[model samples]
Target: MNTVFVVGSLNIDQTIRVPSFPRAGETIRGSDATFSPGGKGANQAVAASRAGAAVRLVGRVGQDAHGAAILQVLAESNIDSSHVKLTDSASTGTAVIAVDDQGENQIILSPGANAALSFADVDAGLATLTPNDVLVLQLEIPRDIVRHAARAAKLCGAFVILNAAPSPLEIEGLFDDIDLLVVNEQEIQDLARLANASGDLAELTETLPSVLGPAVLCTAGAQGAVTFLGRRPVHISAPEVSVADTTAAGDTFVGYLAASLAADRELPAAMAIAGRAASIAVTRPGAVESIPWRHELPTLQDHDTQSAALFLSHP
Candidate 1:
C-alpha cells in the first residue's frame, strides 16, 4: 500500500462555544470551553489513518502535556508518529477558537513549535519516503520548508499535495511543483487576488486556477467542492447535515482524498469518496475525532459527478 506522509503542525485547540464572536477588544461570555487535538497537519494525518491509510506525520511538538497528549491521540488513530519530534524550546502550537450558535467559527493561532520546524527536519522525514507514496503538506509550518519538501517529494516521484491555508502572499511559483493544491474559498481568493469575488465562495471558484495553477481543488463549506484538472471544472456538492463544528472539515476532506488516491482511485472517484467522508465529519464535534472510517461510507455512491455537483452547490 502507498504510505501517506503528512509534514505539518500539531496543535491543541482550545475552543469556546459562544453566542457570537467578540468584536475587537470586547470580551464576551462563552458557554463552554473544550480542548481538542488539532492543527491542519495532525488533523489530516489522524483523519487519513482513521480512513484506513498507512499514515505518517512529521512535525514538532512541545515537551509538555499538550504535545504528550497529541502523541497518544495520534497513536489511537493508528497514525505513525515515529517522526513527530518533541522540543523543549517552545510550546506546542495552540489555537483559540470561538464558535457561534450557527456553527460558524473565528480562530486565532500561535505557531509555537510549529514555527521552529526547519528544512532539516523535513529532509530527515523525506528520507523515509519512497516512490508511489503520497506526500501531504500544509502552510502552518515554515513556507521554505514546505517548498523544500515539495521539491524533494517531486524528485522522488511521490505525489505532492499542498493544502494552502492561512493564505500566503504569493502562490504562483509554489504550484509549479505540486501535483495537487487544495484550498478553501477564502484562501484561494486571498492568494489569487480575485477582485471580482463578492465573497469567499465566488472569489475562489473564479480565480483559483489562474494563480494557483491548473490542478486546484477548492473546498466550499456545505456547498461541496470544485476541481480544475487542466480542463473544465468538476463541481461536487456535499450532502446537507446539521453542523456541530466545522473545525476539521477541510482537513478531513484532504485526508480522505489522500487516502483514496493512495489506494489507486482516480481523481473523480477519490473526490466523491472524500466529499462523502467530509460530509459525515461536519455533522459531529471535534477535529480529528470526527473523521469516519472508510468502511462507514457504504451509502455514498461512487463517482457521481452530477450528484456531487448538486452537493457542492447546495450542501
Candidate 2:
C-alpha cells in the first residue's frame, strides 16, 4: 500500500464535561478535566495508521511533557514520527474543550509549537513522497505551509486531500493543488462564500468538481455525507450509533478516506469506509482513542459501492 504523509499539529486536549454550554460571562460547574493526545494532524495520522496505512507525521511540538505524550502515542501506533520536531520556540499546542450531555462540544485553541512548524523542518521528509503516495493536511498549521506542501505534493503527482476543518477566512488560494476537498456543513458554506461561489450544498457539490478539479465530500454529522467524486453527487447514510463525543469524528473520517483513496479504492468505496469509521467514532470517547481500526470495520474489504448499504447499515 502507498504511504500517507500527515502534515499537521500536535496538541494536548484538555476536556471537561458540562451540563451545557456556559453563557457569556457565566461560570458553571463542570466535570473533572481530562487530558489526552490531540491536534487535527496528529489525530488524523493515528486514524490512518490504525486503519492500516503506513503513516508519517510531519509537524512540531514543544520540548515539554505534552510533546512527549504525543510522540509516545505515535510510536505506539508504529507511525513514523521522525518528521515531528521538538522546538523550543513555543510551548506545545493545546485545546480547551467542553462537551455537553448531547456530545456537542466547543473548543478553544492555543497554538504554540503548532504555529511554529516551518516547511524547512519538513522539506526533506516531504521530498520523499512518491507519485503513488498520499499527503493529507488540515487548517491547524500555517496556511502558507499547507499551500506549499500541497503544491509540492501535487507536482510530484501524489494525491492531496485536505480536510477543511476549523475553516479559515479564505480558501480559494488553497484549491490550486488539492485533489480532494473534504469539509463539514459549516466549512462548506464558509469556503463557498469565500470562493465567491453562490450556491447551496447540493449546488456547490455539483459545481465543486469544476472548481477544485477533482472530488469533494461534505459531511452532515450523523446524517451521513454528500460526495461528488467526479460523478454526480451521492448522499451516503451513516449507521446509527450513540454519540459520546464528537471531538475527532471528522478527523477520523478524513484519515480513513485518505487511506482508502491512496490504496486506489473507488470513490464510493472510499466514502463508505470514511462514513463507517466516523460513525463508529461517535460511539466512543476521546479523540485518538475513538477511531476504529481496519480490523474493526467488517466491510473494509468491500471495495464496491453497490453493497455499501449492507456494510454500513449493519454496523
Candidate 3:
C-alpha cells in the first residue's frame, strides 16, 4: 500500500462546551474542559491510519507532557511518528475550542512549536516520499513550508493532497502540483477569490480545476460535499447523524479520501468512504477522538469494484 505522509501541525486541543458561542469580550460559563490530541496534521494522520492507510506523521512538538501525550496518541493510532521532532524552543501547540450545543465550533490557536517548523524538516520529510506515495499537507504551519513541500513532493512524483483550511489570503503557489484540493465552503470561496475565479459554487468549482489542474472537493457540512471528480461535478450527501462535536469532520474526510485513493479506489468511491467516516466523526467529541475506526465504517460493497486509482502517481 502507498504511504500517506502527513506533514502539518501537532496540537493539544482544549475543548469547552457551551450553550452557544460567547459574544466578544464576554466571559461565559461553560462545561468542564476536555483536552485531546488534535491539530489538523495530527487529526488527519490519525484519520488516515484508522482508515487503514500506512501513515507517517511529520511535524514538531515541544518537550512537554502535552507533546508526549500527542506522541502517545499517534502511537496508539499506529502512525509512525519517527519524523516528529521534540523541541524546547516553545511549548507544544495548543488550540482552545468552544463547541456550542449545536455542534458548531470556534477555535483559537497558539502556534507554539508548530510555528518553528523549518525547511530542514521539510527536506527530511520530502526525502521519504516516492512516486507511489501520498503527501498530505495543511496551512497550520508556515505557508512557505507548505509551498516548499508541495513543490518537492511533485518533483519526487508523489501525489499531493492540500487541504486549504483556515484559508490564507494569498495561496500564490500552493497548487503547483497538487493532485487533489480539499476545502470547506469558506475555504472554497477564499480559494476561488484568490485565484480570481468568479461565480456561484458550481461556477467557482469549475474555474479552480481549470486553473490549478486538480480535482476540487468543496465540503458543505450536513449538506454533503461538491466534488469535481473525473472533471465533472458530483454532489455527495453526508449521512444524517446526531451531532455531538464537528471538530474533526473535515479532517476525517480528507484522511479517508487519501486512504481510499492510496488503496487504488476511484474518486467517487473514495468520497463515499470519506463522507460516511466524517458523518460518524461529527457524532462524537474531541478531534482525534471523534474520528471513527475503519471497522466502525459500513462496508462499501458498492465500491468494491473500483476501476482504478484515479488520482495516484506511479513510478
Candidate 4:
C-alpha cells in the first residue's frame, strides 16, 4: 500500500447550531456548542485512515490543552501523529462554525499555528516519503509550502494531489505536475476568475486543459462530482442520505478518491466510490468522526466484483 503524506492545518472547531445564519452585525442566540477535532489536513488524514489508507499527518499545534485534545482525537482515529509538531509560541488552530437546520455551514478560521507552517516544516515532516507514496496537500497552509511539498513529492516520484480549498486567487503553473486537482464549486469559480474564464461551467471545463495540465475533480455537493480527463468528462451522482452536517463532505471525497487511486482503481469507478463515502459522511456530524471505515462501505463492497469483471473485460 502507498503511504499518504498530508501537509496541512490542524484546528479545533468550535461549532454552534443556530436557527439560521446571523445577518452581519446581528448577534443571534445560539443553541449549543461542541468542540471537534477538524482542519483540512486532520480531516483528510482521518478520512483516509478510515477508508483504509496508511496515512501520515504533517502539521503543527500549540502546546495547549486544545492541541493535546486534537492529538488525542487523531490518536483515537488511529492516525500516526509522530510528525505533528507542537509550538509554545502560538495557540492551536481554531475555527468558529455556524451550522443551520438544513445542514449548511459557515466557518471563520483563526490560522494560529497552521499559518506558521514553513517549507522546512514540510521537508522535515515528509522525510520518509518514497517514489511510490502519495503526497496530499491543501491551501489551508501557505501556498509557498504547498509548492515546496509538491516539488519534493515530484522529485521523489510520488503522486501529487492538490485540493484547492478555502479558495484562492491564482494557481496557474502549479497544477502542471499535479496528478489530480480537487476543487469545489466555489473554488472552481475562483479558478475561473483567476484564469479569466467567461460564461458558465462549460467554459471552465473548456479552459481546464490550457490552464491546469492535470486532471480536475469538480465537486458539486449534493449534485455529485465531475472529473475531467483531457476532453473527456465523467460525472457521478451522490447517493441519497439525510445530511446532519456537511462539514467534512469534501474532505471525505478527497480522502476516498486518493484511497481508490492508491488502490489502483480507475477514475470513474473511484469517483463513484468517493461519492458514496461522502454521502455517508454528510449524514453524520463532526469532521473526522463522521467518515466511514472501509469495511463499513457496503455499497462499494457489493460492487467490487462487478468492477473487477468490468476491468478484466475492458483490459
Best by lDDT: 3
Model 1 clash tally? 10
Measured against the true structure, the TM-scores of the candidates, in listed sequence, are 0.91, 0.93, 0.93, 0.92
Model 1: ten consecutive residues of lowest lDDT: 194-203
**What is the TM-score of candidate 2?**
0.93
**What is each predicted model's overall lDDT from 0 to 1?**
0.82, 0.85, 0.86, 0.81
lDDT, candidate 2, 217-245, per-residue tens: 77878657776545455666777788899
- Which regions of candidate 2 fall more than 4 Å away from where they truly are? 212-214, 300-315
Clashing residue pairs in candidate 1 (N, C-alpha, C atoms within 3 angstroms): 222-315, 223-312, 223-315, 236-308, 236-312, 237-308, 237-311, 237-312, 238-311, 238-312
Supply the global lDDT for candidate 2.
Answer: 0.85
The residue-by-residue lDDT of candidate 3 on 1-315, one tens digit each, is: 699999999999999999999898988899999898999999999999999999998899999999999999999999999989998989999999999999999999999999999889888866868899888999899998888888889998988999987788786566877888998878888887788787666556656888767778877786677666555566666667899999989999999988988888877888889989999999998899999999999876664323222221111
Tens-digit lDDT track for model 4 on 6-122? 998999999998889999899999867999889999998888888888889999999998899989988987888888999988999999988898898999999998888877788
Candidate 4's C-alpha runs over 4 A off are 301-315
Candidate 3 weakest ten by summed lDDT: 306-315
User: What TM-score would you give candidate 1 relative to the actual structure?
Assistant: 0.91
